[model samples]
Structure formats: C-alpha cells, structure tokens
Target: MSPVSSFLWTYAVGVKVLLSQLLSRSFSLPVFPLQNGKVAIVTGGAKGIGYETAKHLSRLGMHVIIAGNHENQGELSVSRIVKETGNEKVEFMYLELASMQSIQQFVQHFKAKNLLLHVLVNNGYIRWPVNQCSPGAAAVMLVPQRNTADGFEEHFGVNYLGHFMLTHLLLDTLKQSGSHDLNSRIVTVSSATHYIGELNLNDLQSRHNYSPHGAYAQSKLALVLFSYQLQQRLAAEGSHVTSNVVDPGVVNTDLYKHTSWLFKLCKWLTSWLLFKTSTQGASTVIYAAVSPDLEGAGGSYYVNGQKVKSADISYDEDLQRKLWAQSCNLVGNPERHQCAS
Candidate 1:
C-alpha cells in the first residue's frame, strides 16, 4: 500500500475501535440548560459540523444565527434547523469570509438589534491548495506561502484574522450578556495539525519558505496561542470574557475539498477507517459553550470534550504575544482593541 493508504487504513481501524468503546459505555451527554435568553452566532454554520452545532444549540433553547458565505446556503441551513427543532428562533445572515467589508456589515446589522451575544463560534474556513490566476483576480491556493489582498498569508487571513476582527466588533455585546453571569465565551475552532507549526518571526507570512500545509499549521497554532493570550489579557484587565480553543477531531467535512487529489484519496481512506460523524466532531464545541464544567474556565485547550495539554509550541508566551501583534497588524487593528471594550 502507498504510505497514504497505509495511514488511512490504520486510521479507519482506530475509528472503529473508538466507536466500539463509545457505544459500549452507554455514555450520556451532560445537559446544560440555558438560564438567560442567550444568543449564539456560528460562522460557517451552513454545513458540516458547524451546522450540527447550530442545530444542537437551538435544541438547547438558545437562539442561533447562522453566518454563511452564501445567502442561499445560509437560508437553507436556518430553515432546516428551525424545522428540525420546531423553533422559530434560528436565523441566517450573509458573511463572506474572504472580505473584511462583509464581516463589518454583518456586525453592524447585529449591533442594530441591540441584542446581547452570549456565544460566538469562529468556524468558517477554506483550504484551497494552490494559486489559480484568473481574469483580473489572483485565486491563491491554501499553500504555505501566498499573500492575500490584505497582504497577509491566505490561511492566516481567513482562519485567524477574519475571526479576530469579528470578535473585536462583537465584544461589547458579549460583555453585555456576561455581565449577569460572567461565563460568556469565545470558542475558536482550531486543529491538531498545529503541533507541527513553528513561528518564524522573520517571515510570519511565509514570504520566503512557504509550504501550504506548514503555513496552515502555523495559523492553527496561532489560534491556540491567541486564545490563551486573550484569556490572559482579559484577566489582566479584569474583564469577565472567556476565550478557549478546541480541535474537533478529524471528521468528514468539506473543509478539505480544495486539497490535492492525493490528499483527498488519503482522506477518503482514513475517513473510511477512523473519522468522526459531524455530530461527534461538534461535541467539544458544544461542551465548551454549555457544559457547566467549563462555567468559569478560560484559556484552556480542549479536544473531544476534555481539557488537555496542548502542543509545547502552543504555550510559548513570547510567541503568543508576537503572533497576536502580527495578527492585529494584518487585520488593521494595530492598537490591539480590547474585546470587552
């Protein structure tokens, strides 16, 4: 077997083993009842695990807003969730992850409602493999070294900076919701590939030594670092907002559709072996958002619903702050605007 195939076969077997264990234990999920009238916004909620999470949250009685790249998909997801849960509280909004203008517009629309935001899920993402120059536009792939229109790396721009700006814009609403309970949260969706990433202070955008996967890993690592740093900043400033990061555990999602054919074949093999269901993949996110166990926890990294030690690189305080600074610079928020301010 090819190395990729071998890996996939091993992964598939692992999944079966894990599933057997899960099924045998009669494991019951903990229920977290929403106390106040909570509102949640889930970016990229139109499909895959994000959609599952929105549906799950709606069933728990929280009003959910699905922010999607396409208006049609957003409407469809919202309609499905409302139909499934028999709740009219779910809604949809348009958000193009690639454009800062769209993000600003979405936030402005939310602000007009004067509603408090109890939870924010940074889940929108894309993974194109390489550049495809077309008429009047440069469509860069998700490779390690490429510049976005904003001049930051592509992965960094979408996965980290976009959410960074969105979170900043919605900070006031989060604070308003948490003033009553002090448990408001920012749940950042990261990935396990982060362990392989390293910080090259000299080339944060991978201008010289760019590898798409490597750059993507760096972005995810930065996300974990950002989560920790934000928590510390809030604590230092004596703010009540909590920030935590989680890895959904590999599942079959469209997040990888842009990968090369070789990668896709490998993924298919492994998914047939050890992949998670969309609902299972979303469990950690739900836990972070609602589980009383995390009521006051902040700056922690979670996987599959349990808090665990992250990769060593994820803890480098100097790196975390540096990454934050760079992210701020890239997003045009160089002043490091306080999320709770």
Candidate 2:
C-alpha cells in the first residue's frame, strides 16, 4: 500500500480502537484460588502484557517461566516478580522466538526439569514499521523486508510459527499434566487487527508485496486459526487440554514501538484514554489461563473478558488444516518426537 493509503488505513484502525476503548468499560477478572504447583510458560514475559500475566500467575503460586531472548531483562523481570509476589518459583528461561534452535533448547531445558505444564501463553510479538513518510515524500517507499532466523517473514515466523512449534513440542507434557476436571490450557495472544488480515497460503513467508501491517495481521489471524484447530484436535482425541485465543484490547505497550510519529503523537495526546494499560490488557490472559469457568472450553476467542467470534475467514476448516500442515512442514513438526537441534 502507498504511504497515504497506509496512513489512512492505520488512522481508521486507530479510530476504531479508540472508539471501542471509550465505549467499553474495564473488565474485572474474576478472582481464582491459588494454582499451587501448576506450571506456565509465558513468552515475552519480561515486559508489557506478558510481564503482567507472569506476575499475576506467580502471585497465584504457580511456577512461572518468563521466556524471551533478552537474558538480562528476563532475569531482572523474574527477580522483580519473585520479590513482588514472593513466589520463588518465578524464573527466566532463554527462548528466542526468531530461532527454532533456541526454542528447541528452551523446551529441552524445561523438560529436563520434569515439571508439569498447565498453561502456555504465546504472547511475544514484534511490529516492524512500514516506512511512515511525510506528505512531501514519495507515496510508496517500501520498507525493507525482515525475516526470522529461519528465513520466514519476521512477523509470521516469530509471532506465529515460533509459538506453533513450541506448543507442539510441549503438547505431550500438557496432555499428561491435565486431568478431566482441571484441563490444561493454551492461550495465544491475538489482535483486533486480525480482522483485516489477508493470508496467501502459497506465500506464507510474505516474500512478495510485504507490509508490516499485513504481515502482523496475518500472523495474528494464523494464531487464531491454529488455536481453534488445536482445540479441535485435543477434543477429538479426548485429551484434557484446551486451546483458546485472546484479543487483548489495544494496550499501551512497546508492541507499538514501530508506529509512525503521528501515531505516537496521538498516543501521547490521548494519555491512555484511547488505549488499555498492559495490566488491563492482561485480564483476559489471566482469565483464560486459570479460570475454572473456562475449563473444558476450547476454541473460544476471548475479547474484553467475553467469548466472541473471530474473523469470518478464521473458521475455514480447510484453511486451518492447510495452514497447520504447512506450518508443520515449516517448523519440522514431523521430527517433533525426537529433539532436533
């Protein structure tokens, strides 16, 4: 899209989000009993909504692993959470979503601990700028494309594919840890932008006509489809595991670090009336993670603390299967039984 078109499109989306934020009241998460001994892995837990979710889970007495690429930040966040929550079980683990090798090592390290896995929160993401230009500048100066360590589109790879591989690698442990009464859960962080997503199955890597907006949306939409598809498989197999997607309302976080100057200006002017804080945005994640109310419920798309329908295309069963199969090939799911470095 041209710079003018991109600006208009972004403005429209931003307006819609701000209007929704104004209309919707804060959702109060229902308090749940302490989840003693249960384990959870929250990717990108060192900051923003992920950090808040990890801290909340830790407060509930659950063993929380803050998985990310930044070792220093991860360790410090873990220490902070431990100190604040008084939960020594809170710790950090190295997991670089951009690299499958790092993901494998993360899983191996977790498995070596022989701990039970109750929740997996796929919450990390990066938003590259789409070259927001001035009125006097060219209308269509394409931002240089970004790729992951595996050569996939940056957004598609780190945000969606990384979590897909991680979930599959840990699926067995999640199943074994869950029971009929208290089912295991997988909560993926999706976005309202998913409604605008357009996925080209043939070009899952976004090798052509790449735009950060489209790439990010496509990745989030993929997560919704993956979550629903995984939910279906878990139910069909009678596994005591559930998979769900959560659209944390547009929260004030570094997720928007790549926004254009104008957008950032709007944010500063609004002073958070137009956006939810990270703590507020994490409500649905915590709700989906441990709420007994959601036990046994799978494939639910949660927003504003209520279950809602996702994008119309997300329900395409055939598309879901195709994406799943393609993702498996991309992530080497066929070799999941044995750890491959």
lDDT of each: 0.73, 0.82
The TM-score values for the models, in the order shown, are 0.84, 0.91
Q: Give lDDT tens digits, candidate 2, residues 231-326.
A: 888898899999999988878876555667887798888846878999999999999999988989989899889999889999999999898888
**Alpha-carbon runs more than 4 Å astray in model 2:** 1-7, 126-144, 334-341
Looking at model 1, residue 55 earns an lDDT score of 92
- How does model 1 score by TM-score? 0.84
Q: Cα RMSD for candidate 2?
A: 5.4
Top of the candidates by TM-score: 2
Would you give me the overall lDDT of model 1?
0.73
> What tens-digit string does per-residue lDDT give for candidate 1 at 1-341?
23344344434533454465345432235777763478999987877778888998999888899886656667887899999987789998877566678788999898888888988998745422234322122222244355665677787777777788888878767877775355688999987766656667677777764666666666777788888988888778666679999888766777664456766786677666556777877888888888878876899988767788888988888888887776666666723556322
Candidate 2 residue pairs in clash (backbone atoms < 3 Å): none
What does each candidate score in C-alpha RMSD?
5.5, 5.4
